[model samples]
Target chain A: MNIIVCIKQVPDTTKVKIDPETNTLVREGVESIINPFDIYALEEAIRLKEKIGGNVTVLTMGPPQAAEVLREAIAMGADDVYLLSDKAFAGADTLATSYTLSKGIEKVGQFDLIICGKQTMDGDTAQVGPEIAQKLGIPVVTYVSKIEDIENGQIKLKRMVEDGYEVIETETPLLMTVIKEINEPRVPSLRGIMKAKKIEIPIWDASDIGAEGEKIGLSGSPTQVVRIFAPEVSKEGEILEGEPTEIAEKLILKLKKGKVI
Target chain B: MSIKIDLSKCTGCKLCVKACIYSAIDVVEKKAYINNNCTLCGACVSACKYEAISISKKKKTAFDEGDYEGVWVFAEQKQGKLAGVASELLGEGRRLADELGVKLSAILLGEKINGLGKELIFYGADKVYIVDSPILKDRLDETHADVLVQLIREHKPEIFLAGATSFGRSLIPRVAATLETGLTADCTGLAIDKENKFLLQTRPAFGGNIMATIICPNKRPQMATVRPKVMKRAQRDDTRSGEIIEETILNPISSRVKLLGFIEELSDKVNLEEAEIIVAGGRGLGKADNFKLIHEMASILGAAVGASRAAVDAEWISYAHQVGQTGKTVCPKLYIACGISGAVQHLAGMQTSDYIVAINKDPDAPIFDVANYGIVGDLFEIIPVITTKLKEINGG
Candidate 1:
């Protein structure tokens, strides 16, 4: 089973702050890390590889700094890492991003399965994995929470839906987007870290992947961000004053008034 | 472009009546007549087998900015019932439609859901599109996208809105991609620019730290998915009436993925999305065992239990119950925080709740800033007292 895990480096959104004066994201001091969900995807891929004998290759599309996540994936258990980084790839939307990633996959060679996190923290668009499948003419399953079995060239899995999980069976050469419920990701061992340090990650540009220039970046993206500003926080609660009992009593009356009880 | 009726081929089967989403078509004396409300969606044209109705072909570019009309809300339904967010989108969609001087319509796809179409009309929709098929009984991304994309291409609505539920989040993006249109996700605010008639889609970015107002200036139909409970639902009025048009799937494409069965997560037995009240815990609870107090208080109030990222990261609670940026965004009627300091990530998920009560030992916790009522005391001391008083109030 040759599995390709797609990962991304995202800003620690929790630490991200908005500059009140300028109304812009204060990203200068914030640290970047592997998108938390993608770690689960990588771990699932590694575990699958461990169970059945095969290699796990990690792929990502971003600026040069995104290679850090590739190294991190390798340290965890990925056998090889490829980075699709270029100025032309900047400012891509989900459509363009997925197209570029698909081109990179075509260049990287064959694979039985492709895996990705449910979404990226910054973009939060879960469309890429399915879109890539559509563009590749392959089948896809989203919000997969568990892999039940993989045999006879077909895989059975559990997919999360609105109310419950759906057990699905599909052929190989398929794509799936997994959620954090799937599995707990493993930490990097010292030996794994050393091996990752010695492996040189290859950077692929639009030309390297034979991608069309118009379909690789800002030009290819159909949507544009017109404006960004700080969301106004209108929380001015009536702070109840008094002893604990008094506060509790006041809260009950308020809840009744709000029809919440 | 406009729909043309062929009087010679007219059978007056009335199938077109059920196919017109806008109630824009009526049959009078064994003939079909197109009304003024029609946006030329061509559902009736497709439903007529004898080619009695046809839309005129117009040569134009893909981004013909002037051709699109009306506002549409994707009415999300689960288990044969419409989700609450559908009404909220209608509330917002009505405003946008009125501003644009266009009609507000809802597109519903499900099996045995014609009843929901009338309900949508009662909740501010001027027209409801119904596509009933066994293939559409369940929410599948590819099938739903195919049906929606077909309808969108035939009848171009200037703005499309859907709730950011699991179904909406999974489906809308695929449709948008297939149509080569732009889509903004998890929008908190949606408005129309009176000047250019463009949809102003505002959503929180960077973990709700800032708001980004996005616009698809060149795209024909601007698309967006809104977070549930953020928008107010339209007031229900059964006296109101509208049109329900049944549509047909020209070519039903079977999905390659086969669903065997479903497994309900034990931790999520009580869905947090529909819970009226939520009692959430934080790291200040000290240990996983301390969550018993939080659960006890919740049980007494008949509320669901939630946890902050800290508690979930500490392995005190399952991720299913975590409410934060990375967790589920909930908008219950009441949210009570115990020992929660209210990190912005945590607040982003539940700040929209109608009422909030915070309890913490620290007087300066940020949770108090957003709490409607605050108790600056140890939760261990305060929670049990509140529970006891609540039981007394309820005579339990």
Candidate 2:
């Protein structure tokens, strides 16, 4: 049972601030942490490895600094780490990024399972995992919250939907994007951290993974960000400031006036 | 592509250097420099205080405007019932089609769902393209994408719209990728650019702090997934009539994944997307146990319970009840937000609700900006009274 987990380093969105004048994200002074959702993918991978004897390799595509997240995964018991970084991989959107990741996975050789977070906080696009699976020509299950059973080259999962959860079964060598409800991620122990510090994470470039230059970066991405601006705030509504009882009375009256009650 | 920095405006704050996730920007001698690793993602451009950064111009791709034709909407259905978002897309698609002087068509795919074609026509579709088969009963992402891609390739529409529901979000992206077209996700606003007849797709980005209007100038069949509840549903008119065209799909590809069964969350029987009223709690409730007040108020009003991401992250509520950018987008008739300070992400999800009533201790909470009626008081004291008063009005 070989498993590969994909992770990314993202800005702590809650701490992110937008500059009013420039209408851009103020990334300065913000902490970069593993995408909260990816932690669950890492945990699930390690748990699967512990249940069935196998190797777990963590993969990521970002700048050199993204290696920090790879090391974090290794500290959490990943057997190997691969960093897909290159100047050519810059400005890649979900499509191009997933293409590059698939190429990297091909370079890493055989794997029975690939796991990813449902989505990244910054990108908020859950398209990459499924797109990667498509690029690899494998089946994918997104928004998986629970792994019910795994045996005989098949795994059953509980996937989240709009109304409820659907039970799904897929063969091995498949891809799955997990949600936070999947499992609790374990903290790395002192010994694990020490081991992580000593392990050498192999960095793969575009050519090293047999990626075509035209399909690896900004040139490969179809979507483009033409303009970004602050969202126009709607007109301020009436605020009734008073004691709890008076405020409640005023709110009720307003609701009644609006015929909302 | 990279952003150019103006040395004259740089203050040596080094903020851009810190903000660069790729470590492409470096500060030296009171100035910031960008290297080859920059992707021009615009994070540092927004972080720079001196207005020192600007993205380089892009080469525009040529597209033939005359080749594209109709405006199409994906009428996504589940269990033979039309999702409300599908109707909403039809309403919006009609507006775009009218602007373009083209027919507004709908693509309805399901098992034995021929009756739904008329329902779509009643809404606004000028033509309903139906593809009925038992193989289409369950949503297989690959099979659906393949079918839609084939339809799109055969009949080229100018603009294609779908709901940003789970199905749409999953299906559209794959189709777009396969077709090598561009797609904008979770759009809050859609309009036809009269000058170019291009779809102007606007969506919230950067945790809802900003809105980005995206265009796919070179791609035919421009696609976008609009968030549910952001657009009005088309008014049903039984007197209206339209063409119903049945299409045939050849031997469908088998899906690698298999659906076994569905398990409903016992505690969350109230579907938030369809709920008429919602009572949501936030971190201001102080503790997980305090959520009982929210549930009590919702129960009295026959509303569903919703929670802010903070509450959901704290494990006070299940993810199913979360209302935010990452959670479910809802537009109930009445949204009673208790103790919610209203982060941008949370506001993005519920701002479209018809009537918003915010209760919080802080008068300056951002929630008040969008609330139709706001109460500046302790939610602990106000929520119970509102519940009691509503009970009294009902003669309980």
Candidate 3:
């Protein structure tokens, strides 16, 4: 079975800060890293490839420097890497993103399974995976915590539910976005790191992916961001100071005032 | 643009209808239906489970020429107390209202909700629209949406804002979808473009990887849901007041969804949402035996015990205690990071905490920068001493 894993390079959020004047993120000095959840997807894909005996190709969409993550993916055991980078691909929302990625996937040829992180860290909108599935007309299982089985063109996995878990079975060539519980990603070995140095990552632009320009970036996106400002911080917190019982009584009194109880 | 519904594919799952904060979808005869009352908002697209709903304009209609101006905030209250988030939205709504040079109105929908409008005025609402009814006693999605949608149509607001709480998140989407405008969720930021009076909704997307600004340029009354704690509550002025316009429901629908005595769930579950001090440990604790140290420290300080993805993955603690993007998003007052290297995935969850304190052997740990206080030492050593000192300070 051939597997394709999609990942993105994101700003290390610890250093991410909003410019006080512009109300925009200050991306200049912020460091970038492979999205953490995507690492689990990469690891799971590599493990599946090892078990079933096949190749794993890692894919990413970002600036030119994003190729670094693809090299890192190669060091982690991916056989090949593809970077979809272009000015046209920039500023894409989830819709535009899913569209571009779908075109990239189509351009890359066929695969038995497509793996992705449940959601990217930079944008918490978990819509892209499902949206990509819809745009590609493929079934998507998200928040997958564990893989139960894979055999005879069929795959089974345990999906995380609100309360417990649901075991789901689907056919091959299916797309799955996994949570961190899927597997622990392995560190790149010395030999693999050396190999990654020589590996060339192919870059794809909007045209290479056969994507319509109207559907990409800000223009292609139906939603437009008008402004971004820090949320107002309001506090009139009543500190329930004392023992547990005393605090609880004070809390109950406060809740009573708010009519929360 | 008008709303369109292919009722054949609709199973009346109510997911779309419920997804709509607007009460736009009327499930009659086991099929979903929409009337001319819809605002043609596309929010129902995200709500539909069966891909049965779509939004477009109807052939021809009047009421299209009205200046859909002004920014309106629903001054939500429970047990006669205005929610803190309501005041927060007002500070934002006031900016939008001033930018547009349009009136800022607060629609108070509740039973005996008259006097509350004055408080909204002091908070920045220029006018208060009071929709008082016994049916509006408690916050029910169906009744509340019905009243809100009615208010929006009768008094056209160019922009609408609500708190991204359980109530605001639930109510606003339906209202926006019913109105057929765009609704952005859990927005971390908001701004007004003075040129067109457009309300820019900026929210963290891709799990906080990027900030996305969503605008409903063509749609009237662009709506957004802002999360609490992300914004400051407007300063209250008992001195400042405004005009109260009492609005009675001209024709109320007999409610189908009944209020079965509200049984507040008393699980004694730690409300990590409002936790001031959080002491979180991770896998570096070595074993489940080490968790005791973390919990002991947490108990001593009346703080909650949060675990890293590593510790949660190791099954050393419950998933609820796990703090990360996939686990829980917390912004506690004081977050004590122990043994966590501050991996990007792990930090996304609790980085919003007010004053962070990091205690780890690695001075290079990423959690330090965000932390107001940093201890470059072993968590095992630091926790015990801190707990002992806290006990002494409290005379425990």
Best by TM-score: 2
Query: How do the residues A1-261 of candidate 1 rate in per-residue lDDT, one tens digit apiece?
Result: 899998888777777765464444555556778988899899999999999979999999876777888989988989989999876776677778888998988887899999999987766767788778776767788888899999867999988765567888888888899987789788899988998888888998889999997776766666666665656665676766677777778878888887788
**Total colliding residue pairs, candidate 2:** 0
> Each candidate's fnat, in order?
0.54, 0.58, 0.12
Candidate 2's residue-wise lDDT over B1-396, tens digit each? 546899999989887775564557888898888886577676677667688988763555645667779999999998899998988899999988888889999999989899899999999999999899887889878788878988998888879999887778777877887876778888888877778666888887656666677777777788888888778889999989999999999877777788889888789555788787999999999899999999888888889999999999898989999998667778888998998899877987888788888888888998998888888888888888888877877785
The reply for model 1, stretches above 4 Å from the true place, is B1-62, B266-269
Error of 2 at A65 (Å): 1.1
TM-scores of the models, in the given order? 0.87, 0.91, 0.55
Weakest 10 consecutive residues of candidate 1 chain B by summed lDDT: B36-45
Model 3 chain B lDDT-worst window of ten: B260-269
The TM-score of predicted model 2 comes to 0.91
Q: Assess candidate 3 and give its TM-score to the true structure.
A: 0.55
For each candidate, the DockQ is 0.28, 0.57, 0.06
Worst 10 residues of 3 chain A by lDDT: A231-240
What is model 2's DockQ versus the real complex? 0.57
Q: Who is ahead in TM-score, 2 or 3?
A: 2
- Model 2 misplacement above 4 A: A233-237, A243-245, A259-261, B1-32, B43-65, B284-290, B313-316, B343-354, B362-372, B394-396
